[model samples]
Target chain A: MREKLIEFRNVSFRYGEEEPWVLKDVSFDIYKNEWVAIIGHNGSGKSTIAKLMNGLLFPQEGEIYINGQVVNQDTIWDIRKEVGMVFQNPDNQFVGTTVQDDVAFGMENRGIPRDEMIRRIDESLTAVGMQDYRLTEPHRLSGGQKQRVAIASVLAISPQVLILDEATAMLDPKGRLEIMSTVSNVQDRNELSLITITHDLREVVQAERVIVMNEGVIWDEAKPREIFAKKDRLREIGLDVPFIATLADELNKSGLRISNEPLNHEELLEDLWTLHSKM
Target chain B: MDITFKNVDYIYQENSPFAHKAIENLSFHIPSGSFVAVIGHTGSGKSTLIQHLNGLIRPSNGEVHIGDFRLTNDDKPKNMKELRSRVGVVFQYPEHQLFEETVAKDIAFGPENFGVYKRDIEKRIKEIIPAVGLSEELLERSPFELSGGQMRRVAIAGVLAIKPEILVLDEPTAGLDPRGQKEIMEMFYDLHQKENLTTVLVTHSMEDAVKYADHVIILNKGTKYMEGKPEEVLTQQEALNKVQLDVPEMIEFLYAFEKRFGLPIPFKRQSVKQLADEIQHAMKEAGSHE
Candidate 1:
């Protein structure tokens, strides 16, 4: 049987006892090697969902099952090893001055041997295409490079899944693309499950599955095309549709009938060409 | 307006071992009352260029002049407080800069610092708060308690209380959800129209540059790469790509149409709706023969 990597069985959480529940009746199952995008607008409890997966925030109402081990005070420390987290703001996340040192830190905490740690650090850094900059100071790197290092740090630990908490939001367009491209490569090479928590629709265009959150609950969940089909519903929740999807919708509204549900430039071009030739 | 750089050069920590050049021999200008957009790759020195306009950073070897207040390699005072007041600068993540107990106090900080009287500051806050879509009732609450969108407005209000003739925003919509981004951009457009505000915008969104900017200046590797009206800058897509800046996909699509059909269409148009309308008209006109 393909293992149930992470299962959130009707989980709920809040910042404080008096506060309204940030996550209510949330439930989903993430499988091995699936790249899932948790889509939401600001204050939608998407970040809280991620925190719960990594054991940073324990669910208040229900339980989180990681590899069939329930996440609780007793098993959280063990669960953290199975789910690695890469937070936003790489500047704040760097615990080490140099890139190599940062990548080695998590392994060091795990009591891995010095030589094995060194080998894995190199492997992870190279996997993220940041081996050349391993000796460079983390602070001196750009946002994208810093984020790659952050990913490398997590990858060194070799968790079954990596949670990126809006890790690409703050970067410039070029930087964002670089980070996403690197992440895509790593996901393919390592077959690591990815849970990207973000509002940027562009970042999640090719995700295997998408779970859209609204006001602490799953508003809708579907495959990328199926989910993006509800363009108006998505926009109503203060989220922009993927650019190509947006273009297709606008074209449809204007009577320029396009057939394909394109989420990107190349696909949009292909669809438009078919329509133009048919005309 | 007309912010010509004129061989402007700026160095960070000059004469020290850690000395680095930020902007080197750069030159450009934003005409008065015209919205100019600045785009550049990271470390291309656009931030330094913006700071130069307000005298926040002085050139190490060249000079920069704003209307009358000038900055040179060797001249001008240490404090350009007057210059700063007239040129309202809204920073990226301006919400993070908010530190007042109340929104009104936060907005009042800039004017009060510049010796604007209490009554005038109150009047200024009242005038602009609504413009930013924040009501007066929300003014007494802690600035931190407001939503990110509202907090950004408070920060903008802080800058607007100074009654600047020119507004320079460095990625005002960065880190905002698309809805929040649209809200802020529309608010800026409104402010620019209602007050005749001369706006210099630094943005990563080529769509925003084409949508709002009358003129566009592009920098690459700390030097001027291109400068023209939006139509002029966007027409040369290859140069923009070379500098790692994205052109609006719609604009690219329109250009492809002209290339394929040899259609005498204006490809510089940015609006997708406008392009679609033009395409239908052309098609229907041609199909009349069929």
Candidate 2:
């Protein structure tokens, strides 16, 4: 059986009494070594889940358990050690002048010994493919490079669950791909429970499972392919699907007999090739 | 107004130790009332180029011409107020600049500063609120009270209240969701058409560049890398890839399909249904010939 890494039970949260609940009775469990994408439109409470997980905010009505430990203030510190979150703005998260210093900042805060911190800084930067840029200043790096450094800093803590809260939202397409591939590499090398909170469908395509958030509630939970197949409903909730999925849906509507719902370009091409061969 | 940059260069902190050449020898002509999209990776000088469109920053080496107005290396335009009224710029994350008590006051800020009549400012606010797809009920609320997407619309409305002949947008839809992005882009395109404005869009989205722009310009490392019609410039995938750029998804799909099937499928900005029809026809013809 897969181990449960984090669980939110009967969670309901709001910023203040005047404000409406942002997340209402939301319950979900993240399993060990699995990738889950939390997707929603803005103001949809997708990001609240990330904050709740790391103990930045406690739910008003419910409890969040990290590895079976209740996430109250006393246990919050321990929960943070296991859950390292990379937030949306790359510029805001950067706390060091140089790349190496930035990677070491987290460990320094935790009072890790200098020798071990130095070792981890090297290992984590190498994992993100940013080893060559170790001495570069934060301002000199690209948005994608800075985000990777943020990932490296998180990895320095050796967390079991790494939460990327719209980490690639501010990056260009090339940068987005870099973060996605870097995350894939880190997951390959470590036993990580990765939760990516984003509205980006391209990122969602890579996730093993998707959690759809709409209007402060969990709308649906399914595999990425299953989520993409609900293209119209996804759009109705103010989200989009990848190009291939949309194209497949369009072709199917136009009387093209596609046997399966293709998720990406390669699969779509293969389906087209099969149709062409039969013709 | 038509814009021309003749061998322009801009150096930030030119004489100091922190001196950096932000743009170099950048020369381009934007004809009056044309929609031009400028695209490049971060630090590729896209921001520096747009600053020249208005008189935000004067060129360090050469001349920038906005119709009859000229901005040269040694001289600042005396009529900067007049030039600014004609060119409205919506900067990235424009909502952050909003500080007014009400949306009406915020949108009216631009025109009021330009000496528009008080009555006329109110009229412009009424007209612009709808143009940006925000209901008039939002006009009384503080901009800070609005959602992120709504605040962005309010900021765009502020720029539009000036009724600029030249609309220069620096990624107006940067942080919006998909529906919000589509809505904002469509609003800008409609404004571009109805007002006959010369629009300059600096963005990171190749998809938006292909869908809306008549012409596209690519900047690389403080220099003009390429400029042409959108279809022509975007289909050159290898060249774009060299600069760490991507073609629009439609064009990319076609390119990949051609390579995989050994069929020469020309790239076109068409709906998926149309593409499907063309692919089916191609398959029929190829099968019959075989």
Candidate 3:
């Protein structure tokens, strides 16, 4: 059986008594080494969940468990050690002058040894494919390179869970792809659980499971294919289906045989070729 | 207002050791009331080119003509404020520029600065609120109290309050969600048509360029890499890839289909439904030949 790394039980949160609840009775479980994507429109409470996981915010009712321990004021410090977060706006999160120095910031905060910090900084930089830019300053690098450095800093601490809250929203298309591929490569060699909060459906294709949020509630939870199958419903909820799925649906409507849940271009083309040969 | 750039060059910190040319010999003409998309990667001179449109920066070499205002290194229009009032630039993350206590005041800030009459500013505010998809109820509320998307709309409404003849958008939908992105783009397109405004959009999304732009200019390393109609320029996948860009997904799909079926499907800015119909027709024709 798989282990449950994180759990939220009947959690509800709000900033104050008069403020409306941002998360209402939200419950979910994340397993070890799983990649889950949480998607919602702006102000949909998706970012609230990321903060609640790392104890940045506390629930007004019910409880949250991280690594089989309840999150409380006393345990918050220990819980933070297990959960590392990368937020939106690459410029706001960067602290160090150089690439290597940025990766060492988190480790230095925990009073890690000099030799150990050196080893970890090197390992994390190489993992994100940014080893050659160790001496480069933050302003000199492109948006994509800065994000990679942010990812490496998060990895240097070696947290069990990594939550990226709209991390790629500020980046261009090329920068978005670079961060996505870097996260995939890091996951292949480590047992890290990734929670990506985004509104971009293209990034959702990489997740093992998807959780859709609407109006401060958990609207749906399923695999990527199952979630994308309902194209009109997604559109109604202020989300968009991927381009491949939209094209596949158009083909199906036009008396062509294609799967309604094609995740990528190659799959849709393969299905079309099969149908074409039989015709 | 038509925009023309002739042999323009913009250099940062000119005549110093740190001097670097941001735009080199860039020349393009955007006819009055036409929508143009400037496509490029980061640091590719897209921002520098747009700054010239509103007379924000004088070109180091050559000349720029926007309507009757001509800007060169040696001379600038005496009425620079009037030129600015006619060109509206909705920059990336415009919400950050909001500072007024109420939405109504924030929207009125621009027109007030341009010496617009008080009653005219109020009239523009009323017409702009609903046009940018905002309710009248929020006009009295604090701009900081609104959501990110709402703040962006309010900022855009401020730009429109001046009633500019030309609109420049610098990735106006950068941090918005999918639905918000569509709504904002559609709103801009609607305004572009109704007002007969010349639109210049600097964006990285090839999809947006293909959807809304009649002409596209691709920039690479401070130079014009290519310029033509969207269908003619964007279909060159190899050339775009050289600049660290890709064709839109529709064109990419068509290319893959051509490779798999040994058939060519010309892209004429077709919608998905139209493209599907063409694909269906192509498949039947191939089967009959076999």
Best by DockQ: 3
Comparing 1 and 3 on TM-score, the stronger one:
3
Residue pairs with colliding backbones in model 2 are none
For A138-228, candidate 1 gives per-residue lDDT tens digits of: 7699989999999999999889999999998878889888888988999999868999988777777868899999999999888988888
Query: What's the lDDT for residue A134 in model 3?
Result: 97
Q: Second chain only: TM-score per model?
A: 0.94, 0.98, 0.99
Clash totals, every prediction:
5, 0, 0
Q: Residue B69, candidate 3: how far off, in angstroms?
A: 1.1
List-wise, what DockQ does each model earn?
A: 0.50, 0.70, 0.80
For model 2 the local lDDT of residue B228 reads 95
Task: Candidate 1: list runs displaced more than 4 Å.
Answer: B77-79, B256-265, B268-270, B281-290
Worst 10 residues of 1 chain A by lDDT: A269-278
lDDT of 1: 0.84
lDDT ranking, high to low:
3, 2, 1
Residue B63's lDDT within candidate 3 is 97
Deviation of model 3 at B179, angstroms: 0.7
